[model samples]
Structure formats: C-alpha cells, structure tokens
Target: HVTLVPSHPSYAVISENKRQVRYQAPIHQPLVKVKYFYGVLGSPSITSGKHYWEVDVSNKRDWILGVCVSLKCNEKWNFLRPENYQPKNGYWVIGLRYANNYCASQDAVKYSDFQDSSRSTPSAPWVVPLFMTIFPNRVGVFLDCEACTVSFFDVTNNGFLIYKFSNCHFSYPVFPYFSPMTCELPMTLCSPSS
Candidate 1:
C-alpha cells in the first residue's frame, strides 16, 4: 500500500562528483518537501580549491515541481551551510564553504552521529525575532561567511541579486542551506515554477 504522509519529506540521494540527480513519482502523486543526501568528493592534493555546488530542477512532463520555496540547513558535522538564500530562476547559490581544498582540512563536524546519546543543540539567535521583509509575500535571508560569498540571479537573464553576509551563524560543518525565498505576485510578477 502506498500512502502519502505529510511528515515524510522527499529525498534526493546524490553521489560524489555527480552533477545531476533525478526523481520520478507517479503522475498522480504530489511531492511537497524535498531532502538531499550528498557527500563532497575529496581531493588528495592540498591545492585543489573547493568548487561551487549547485542543484538544478528540470521538468519532465506537465507535472511540475515548483521553484524551491523553503530551505533549511541540516545540522550535521562536516556539513557546510545546507541552505542558501533562494534564487529566482535558473540561477544557483555558489561558493559556500570553509576549507579551500579537500586535503587542507575538513570543515567542523557537529552532531556526533545520528544516534549519539551525548548530543548538544547549537544556540539560536538571542533576539528570536522575525527577519526583514523584501517582497510582499517573500522575505530574503542572508548568511555571512568570511571564507566565501553566495550570489543569486535570474536564469533567463544575467540580472543578479548579490547578497553579502558577515559573521553569519551556522552550526553545521557543511551548512545544508535551504531557501524559503519566494515571490508573492502570481501571474504578472512571477513565472510558473514548472
């Protein structure tokens, strides 16, 4: 029996050094959430710098997966920012990580293992306040890492929205950056995600 549960998020499992992954669901089923599991390819040479990581969405049929509306970084050790500020169209958020090369050093790893009994939850912001509002329906969130910068832009055109953040708080070694970056406008202002 195949049942859809709201608690179960869809996952995309990717291998190291792979550029693309695909997910196919029954034409009748609808997917609401997406999760990804990936491992960065390690380089033996100390000088091999990091590479920009990107995830792109492709539509196969009339069934469409909407643009990424929300993002959350998975809190894990060796995790870079898992989430990123949302991009509007065809663009990707790139250049996010601490170590310059694979052989240099590993990013700080958090969360002992999935089952470590002695686990510590990182502290949250002191204010616990809401973020700023950029568009009527969507809000823009930024992260500032001294090591790298993340930029987003429209895929159709070259127009870019460059966001800079400094001293951003991230607990994971590799931040699983998620983006809840979406627009409020329906027909005119925004194009369909598919």
Candidate 2:
C-alpha cells in the first residue's frame, strides 16, 4: 500500500504519488509529537491464504480496516499513538469513528476480554462501540491466517458480518491496514470480485 511511513509523520497529507487519497485535518506536523491524527496504509504481508479485500466506503465518514504487524516488525510499538491500535501490539482494526461512531479498537487488547483466550492480561486501548444495523457502503476485509481471525464485512449491507477480531495473536507477517479518517471522500481500494 505504498508504504513510506516514518511513524506516520501525520501522513504528510497522504500522498506519495496518490492512490486516491483526500481527507485532511491533521496538519501542523513537523516530526513526531502528534497527539491524535490518523493515517496508515500498509499491505503485502499476509502469511497464509484465505484473503479478501474491498473498500469503497461510499460517501465515507471515517475509516480503518484490519490487520497489522509490519512497520518492519513493529518498530518497537508507538506508531504515533491511538494508544497503539491493538491486538497485543499488532493491530487488528475496525473503524468509522465520529461520524456515526462505529468503533472497535482496544489496544494491547482487552475489553470484556476480546474473545476471551483465558483473558491474557494486557490493557490500555479500548474503543469498542459497534452496534450496527448495517450501514457499510462497502467494506469486506477478511484475513484468516489459519483461523486466527480478523473479519469485517458489510460490503454494502448484504455481506454483513461486521465485527470480528477473534483470538488473533499472529507473531509476524500480517498486513492490509488502512485509515482514511479525515474526509474529502474517495478512500477507494476495490479488488475482490473474482
């Protein structure tokens, strides 16, 4: 996904030769100290099979879709904070915050026990809100590294299966991550029809 992320340096208004990105509001950047601004687009790492992708987010309002663990193997965590968007330091996301508030993030993982694997202690980032009635204009991300899970879908409401980040603790090689959260529309990345 065109990686050039120096700790996301506020995404530099998102353009490293453009794959259609527009949505600013996190400017004022000049090396690290950013408190709350989002941008990360990473791909190519998967580690297994059963992969799928889609994202049009029609009339988008804020976005983020799952799978992480790449900044060349977690650069010692601190990818510019959202508390480190997490599933034990390697994120497995799901977002659409502040426009309708369809949230799901719980850094380092823990919140009613993110699927309860004997509640293996680790906490600090929790945003869980997801109570959808189906309003996903297009989003179908499914990664199953031998069933360690990372599923999110609504692909315009018929493929609805919106919240699922179960028991995932992949120790390296995980990709496909995005965050189009400021809005000028067009967070397009659709390639899943075959």
Candidate 3:
C-alpha cells in the first residue's frame, strides 16, 4: 500500500484520513481557461524498479489517474490545462471525462487513411470512447521505472488494459497522481488485501 502526499493543498483537498482526495479550484483565480483541474501526488516517490497501486473511484464522475514527476507546491498556482498534463510536462495520466470518454496525455497526431480522403487530428491525447459500456469502479496503475513504462488497468473489468505509456523518460522520481475533478465524491486509495 502507498500513502497519498497532500502536495497541492489548493488544487487537491485531501481527506482527514488521507485515503481520499477532491479537486479544488485555484485560490489565486487565474484568467486563463483551465481545461483540467490539478491533483495530489502519492507518497514515497518511485525511483527504480516496479510498483503497482489501486484507486477506488466508484463514486466519482470525473477522475484522472497515473503518475507525475513532481507535485506543485500550493504557494505556486500555475494555470494548467489538459494539454499541459502530457509527459513533456512531467505528467503521464489517463482520465475519464464526465461523458464517460477516456483519454490519455499524449501528443496529438493526424491520421489519414489510404482509401478515404478524410484526415483527422486527435485533439485530446488518444481519446477513446468506452465501447464496453461498463466503466471500472477500481483502477490499477503499474509503473516500471527501468522499462520507462506506465500502464493503467480496469481492475473492476477483469483487469483489462485501459491504457499504457511506453518509452517514457522519467528525469525525476515519479509519484502516483489522482484527481477527482469537479465531483464531490472523494477518490480513495485502496489497501492491499490480506
């Protein structure tokens, strides 16, 4: 089991028990439009080897899960948007939007088909619609520091692979990140079974 680090007091309001967290608006109130709210980091940064953890987001409508290089201090409020949460910004995360759409933090690329004359660019990092029609209540995160890979799993869905980040460059130690978005329900970190 891992402990949550209440790193962003303004962005992430942690519960007293430290098992749950809720997203909070910025205190400074920036003018720039923020697409994605901030989140808190888990304790005991992973510097090497492999680690896995789970989060219970059964009650949340919108949430984000993955890892980040470092948590931003509460004193400094940077107006962060969805585009800024990519690996380049030290964040490797995937999230569920309110509409139940899943997305990852990746560079937008255009895809063209040889037969079709249509060209499309993915606006959000690898946006994928949930075809299974069943959202996972619990999420599993696996990180391999040596392999530079981070993978997410739908624990409630027979441990199905939700998303994966490969060939990642972890310049700094990474910690588990969680965001409940605007949902009032608290996102809890699950304990290992005995």
Cα-based TM-score, every candidate: 0.27, 0.28, 0.79
After TM-score superposition, the amount by which residue 152's alpha carbon in candidate 1 deviates from its true location, in angstroms, is 2.4
Which regions of candidate 2 are displaced past 4 Å? Answer: 1-24, 27-58, 61-66, 71-138, 147-154, 160-176, 181-194
- Better-scoring candidate (TM-score), 2 or 3: 3
Predicted candidate 3: what Cα RMSD to the true structure?
Answer: 4.6
lDDT of 3: 0.74
Q: Which pairs clash (backbone N, Cα, C closer than 3 Å) in model 2?
A: 107-125
Question: Per-prediction RMSD in angstroms?
Answer: 15.1, 16.1, 4.6
- Cα error, residue 49 of model 2, in Å, equals 11
Best by TM-score: 3
Give the local distance difference test score of model 1.
0.24
**lDDT (CA) for every model shown?**
0.24, 0.66, 0.74
Q: Write the per-residue lDDT of candidate 1 for residues 112-147, one digit (tens) a residue.
A: 645585887332211111122221121122222344
lDDT of 3 by residue, 23-120 (tens): 76656787564565767778888889999988988867788878887643224322356656677667788888874677786855557533344876
Where is model 3 poorest over a 10-residue stretch in terms of lDDT? 71-80
Total clashes, candidate 2?
Answer: 1
